[model samples]
Target: MKLIIKSLIMILFAAGAYAADEPDMKAGEDIAMKGTPEGATACFACHGTRTEENKTGSFPRMVNQSQYYILQQLKDYSSGARNNAVMGPIAKALTDKEKADVAAYYAKILFPTPKVKKAASAVLKRGEELAVVGDLKIQVQACNNCHGPGGMGMAPAIPAIAGQHANYLEAQLKAWKDGQRKNSADLMGPIAKRLSDKDISALALYFEQVQINAGKAVAK
Candidate 1:
């Protein structure tokens, strides 16, 4: 009986170690499509597939986002730093390796650029100013300083927000401003606090309509 118990423990440890190895994109793809037997919901239910857009506009586009960014977000959600009723449960359901694998899988997929209706010119202009040239009066820096030109994203961490869903962007900004989301408090928190509701709306709309070459190298 002692020998059997020891052997079982060894097998479990080995399995855990294997799972922590390099990310497996194939496993991630399967999890994204089918969810896990451990009670997590399928990612496709909210995020949609590469060919299909999530018309709800509540969920942000996931394709080609930085793997590191995605992984960190998942970690934040699991830890309750980024409070989301939906994402929290899902992130907790996934193992550390599963999160890494899923992030890697999404980062590799080539998604089509989204097309959204443009907001009023004035709104877009205000948003463009904020994104390209930070307001001196408010002492805010241009969003592009970190997000990269056209929101193409800075390599391993920052995510590409260009052509993302406006509704999702707006909601996230509001969440940060309201102190509901604290995962990126040092950077986004202050910036978002300075943005009025109108500013948030305009910025969201502006980014939704801006398109860029997905394959282009983002500024480091």
Candidate 2:
């Protein structure tokens, strides 16, 4: 409540249009925690509250993300470039400034630690192999090739996939393979299509246990 009030106050006192300056982070935080009644939705409802002790969830973690990445995704959703039923409307409703604001807010948050137990040794090994050096037999590239060291993302596009939910990762991989998700890197579709069930589970579970904030390194 207090945070919301402060955000409102900041907006009230602020002067001039936002064509050239940094976004209002306080306002963004409010929107993430409390969506505008008619415009957008609270991000925390699906994206997790970002609390220190919160468990990993099916929704992608948003904190510690690149600001440019978040804004681009929102813009893509709004423009129909990303085809998510739930996010499309919400992104469409948000004003450009709102999108920028919230993106800035989330970007400043700390990346969460691993919540799930580590995968079995065999699963872990295969996952690492696939992530670090992909499978030549399947024509798959390593996960780290684009996601940067530790899956920190390349910024302005791509995203940090380390420590994301296993279910979410697996579902997205399957979605790409099945053509259920059209918003993606062109390279992802063919790669996903070639993945076996073993690859999907191995990659998902492997990355889920990776801690981007805990000294995890992106494979060289």
Each model's backbone clash number: 0, 1
TM-score of each: 0.86, 0.83
**Model 2, 1-220: lDDT tens per residue?**
2443354344334312223258898999899889987679888878866665335466677745777778878888999887888899999989988999988998887754655876788998898899889888876778887677766665545578887778888988998889877765355777888998788999988887777645454331
Off by over 4 Å in 2: 1-20, 52-56, 214-220
TM-score attained by model 1: 0.86
Clashing pairs in 1: none
Position 18, candidate 1: lDDT: 39
**What lDDT does the true structure give each of the candidates?**
0.80, 0.75
For model 1, how does the per-residue alpha-carbon lDDT over 1-220 read when each residue is reduced to its tens digit? Answer: 2443354355345434532467899999999999999978999899988788778899988855877778878988999988889999999999998999998888888766666776899999998899899788876778887788878787555678887888999998998899887776656777888899999999898888877564653211
